[model samples]
Target: MLRFILGLVLVVGLWSAAPVAQAQNADIEATISAQLEAFKVDDFDQAFTYASPTIQGLFRTPENFGNMVRGGYPMVWRPSEVTYLELKETAGFLFQRVMITDAEGAVHLLEYQMVQMDGTWKINGVRLLANPPATA
Candidate 1:
């Protein structure tokens, strides 16, 4: 009887967790979509809105952030398609792994950190796939 009750509890727990998971994924996708739209139209201000607060503090201004994305992370600056998969939690924050295809048809793997701030999921950090620098 105890084992059966435990099993029931586990099932109920997982079922209740589903909506939160789905909402998280939806928020991530919406964020990427908004950022991509801003990039396409060269709307730096709107693009800045998608950035996590930590990111905003790092770059200090939208122009600098925009410049970095345009220069350093070129894939993110000009993504043609963004697909998200597999959300994971790390240290009380949610992380999303996504693959973005750039205008040049190159694929880039990116991980986005999502956190709850003011009752909404906001992107906080982005990790690019590691790549060896072009050695001269």
Candidate 2:
């Protein structure tokens, strides 16, 4: 009876947590989508607002952050298409995978590290991942 109760508790706990996780995922995706829209119009100031305090402190200003994106992440800066792939939590951090198709038709996978600050989701960092080799 004790084992059955414990299993029941575990199942209930997981079921209750699903909605919260789903909400978090939706918020994270919205934040990224807003930032990408800003990037599309070269509105760095607006895009910077989605970044976490740590990233803002490191970049120092919107222009600097925009410059970095333009130079180092041109695909993100000017993506022809963007698609959200997955959101996963590891080591207490949430990472969002996004697939971007550049103007030249090359696809790039990027991981955006996200954090919650004052109940709002902010982008903490972004890393470009290497593409898997063709299986042909």
Candidate 3:
């Protein structure tokens, strides 16, 4: 029947798309992990490379960006544990959720806005989720 054929087509399309979505998520996670590793080693220049062009322009220099992270997001700057959560899209923008445990063992939930530039995922910005974390 026509309905059955259309349903089958939809299912097939989604089935093939699953792998592409998974790969994209993996790439996004890798970018975040690399930035965290760079922060661990105090390599601002390396960490800054993962940021989106807009962020780079706003910070203007790696040192400025590093200082901002060190002061404003101490948890991210020196996270003791990092866990990647769900990646969601809202209004055509993708945001990757992450749970980071700071050096003091405090848990912080953050959403990293991700943007793809020239076939690579880059971190556009990060925002801390409010209290009672993970509820976001």
TM-score top scorer: 3
TM-score of 1: 0.87
Among residues 3 or more apart in sequence or in different chains, the pairs in candidate 1 whose N, CA or C atoms overlap within 3 Å are: 52-123
C-alpha lDDT of candidate 2 relative to the true structure: 0.94
Between 2 and 3, whose lDDT is larger?
3
Backbone clashes, candidate 3: 0
* lDDT score of residue 93 within candidate 2: 92
Off by over 4 Å in 2: 1-4, 133-136
Model 2 Cα lDDT, one tens digit per residue, 10-128: 99999999999899999999999999889989999999999999999999999999999999999988899888898998999999999898999888999999999999999999999
10 residues in a row with least lDDT, candidate 2: 127-136
Stronger candidate by TM-score (2 vs 3): 3
Candidate 2: residue 97 Cα off by (Å): 1.4
Can you give the TM-score per candidate against the true fold?
0.87, 0.89, 0.93
In the predicted model 3, the residue pairs found to clash are none
lDDT for predicted candidate 3 compared with the true structure: 0.95
